[model samples]
Target: MDMRKMFGFLFGLMVSLWLGVSLALAQSGYPQPTATTLNDFAHLLNANDAAAITQLLTDLKNEHGIEGTVVILNSIHDYPTGDDTIEAFATHLFNTWGIGDKADHKGVLILLAAQDRKVRIELGTGYENQYNDEMQQIINEHMLPAFKQGDYGRGLYQGTRGVIATLTGIWPPDERPVQSGGGSNSPTPVTTASSSRERSDGRMGILIFGAFVVIVGYLILAHIFGWPVGNSRSDDDDDYHSWSSHSSSSRSSSSSSSSGSSFGGGRSSGGGASGSW
Candidate 1:
């Protein structure tokens, strides 16, 4: 073919591929979030439960500067692109929606695919790797029981509460108080010292493990070189300090939202845990 015809054909092929990809992505079965905190597309939560969960998440964001959202879908397999596992779907949706601050990366997504009997707690890059265990614990201790009993609303609410507790070190009221005119109710504020204790224990465990590794490494090096091992110091304190400093500095400021408010443009690198009931 002539150069002109060849170039034209190549351009046409590129355009066709681009259009096809765009169309496929557009029909990927991800629902647009209408509310900032909750998108109950599966109709798993009742009006009260939904409102309560929304209020809980809204308060969490405003007070603690952590952006969180919950999504409920009937089944991923119901759509052409929903055939993927819950983990992939949650990660894609979380990044696509930008659930938290782009700079802070403090976003969390609680995804429930009801028909599939699967759930995922997707955390942003801001969270530590160890939180995966904590997320799994939340699913196992708080969520799975309700799910097995077919109490989806309870399961989701409890799961959300567990998430909030884990992140904030405080649990809000279990239910939102009644409001006038059927508007969003404000739950009475409550606090507890238990979650804080739990977080401290987790941190202590990590520090101990780190120190143990450091000591073992020092012993091994000393033995190899036939050097004295009278004294050794660990910089675990510095490491822990740096981690806390980063977490505090990277928190994104929360802004008020309405029904039309969207996510905060944050991204996640698939840091979370998944479960099946």
Candidate 2:
């Protein structure tokens, strides 16, 4: 083939490939939320479960003025702009949807990425940072167990209730199960400010001690090797499995439709805990 013809063909092939990839990426972007309370894109929840959760969130908003959003997706990396880290994705979605009241900033996002085996409890900036530990406890004690057992609905429902109970004293209705399992799997009470501070202090102390040990070891090694140790190195650091059991319309008509104005222009500054099951 002539050089000119070969060059033209190659250019066309590259352009076609680029266009195809761009189109695929555009199609894979994270879905915009349709409901204020629950966006079960993975279709994991049953009708009854969805309705119950919706009702709880509605009551929560009415009584406490706190907005809650639950999102379940197949994978965090399935879409463009979706983060591999549940924490990042949850924060982005929380802010993107404005999950809480703009002025009060009382918002909570419960995200379950099924394929990724990760979950996150993202809180709005209105909350204290210590709440992250409580969130972590919830994931560890309430959510992961049921999830590991292949009970996504129960896991999510219980986790949502845990969040509500932590934020507001009101727990879920007695009729519905508050937690998924028994045998020493009960949810832990939210940590007090004093306790959280103590834990933080303890962690800091351990870190300092560890750093000191490392420095001493490095100095000894450097002296023995007769090396110049002038260099310093700084190191800086849901849910789709159950969809086939029911129909989409069934889910939408239940809890999905209940969220009229799902979010309230609230924003989160990446305050939450992430976990894997």
Candidate 3:
């Protein structure tokens, strides 16, 4: 072949390969934010589960004026942020969607990557301090267990409830039996019963105490800054069998309907954490 023709052909081949790779990468990346009504782009959760979660989120917003959403994706390999860490991708999404009220900047995004076995709770600027460590614990303790068990719906539900409970000052149900201590001398029957009750109360007291500490700390900070308690900020994974793909058509149609949804102009400074199960 002539030198000019050879160079042209090589250039064309390179361009074609590059375009193909770019298109594939785009396809693999996270789906664009479409619906404001609980996006399940990866189709991880069933319709019933998705509806329930959506209602929970909506109620949280309506009753508490807190803005939050759950996002489940198949993978983050092609996340537009190009950051290997799920944390970055989540933060980017949180900001991109403006998940919270613009004035309050209070937003929480629960991002779960099923194939990647990763999860993240990304918070807006208002919630950085309030939702960080405790939120991490919730993901590690509540969400990761369900995910590891191949229960994405349960995992997301539990995780969402955990966040709500934390914010609403409610404690999760405890199933552990209470213990009673007694001396070598036999105690009165009433005393024994009371002791057991006291121990049970003590367990609840500890949890309340912990929560009180957080609330008081938050209040003090708020008072010092002349702000209110409504402000706050808001991870993990495991390996197991992958969920079967189903209802793609429904999901796509939902996404299209939700395309009109937009962010509330909220922003984030990379607040929140991430984890894997």
Predicted structure with the largest TM-score when compared to the true one: 1
What TM-score, over all chains together, does every model reach?
A: 0.61, 0.60, 0.57
lDDT of 3 by residue, 41-131 (tens): 6656656667777877777778888888899766665344476878878877777667888998888889987767899988889876777
Give model 3's TM-score versus the native structure.
0.57
- Top lDDT hit: 1
Q: Which portions of model 1 miss their true places by more than 4 Å?
A: 1-28, 176-259
Q: How accurate is candidate 2 locally (lDDT)?
A: 0.70
Tens-digit lDDT track of model 2 for 41-146: 6666667678777877778888999989888776766555747577778887787778899998889989887767889899999994758998999999988988
Better of 2 and 3 by TM-score: 2
- Cα-based lDDT at residue 111, candidate 2: 89
lDDT string, candidate 1, 114-214, tens digits: 76788999999888464898899999988888777666667778899999888888977788444344323122111234324334544564565456445
RMSD of each: 22.2, 21.7, 24.3
Output the worst ten-in-a-row residue range by lDDT, candidate 2: 235-244
- Per-residue error at 74 for model 3, in Å? 1.0
- Predictions in order: lDDT: 0.71, 0.70, 0.65
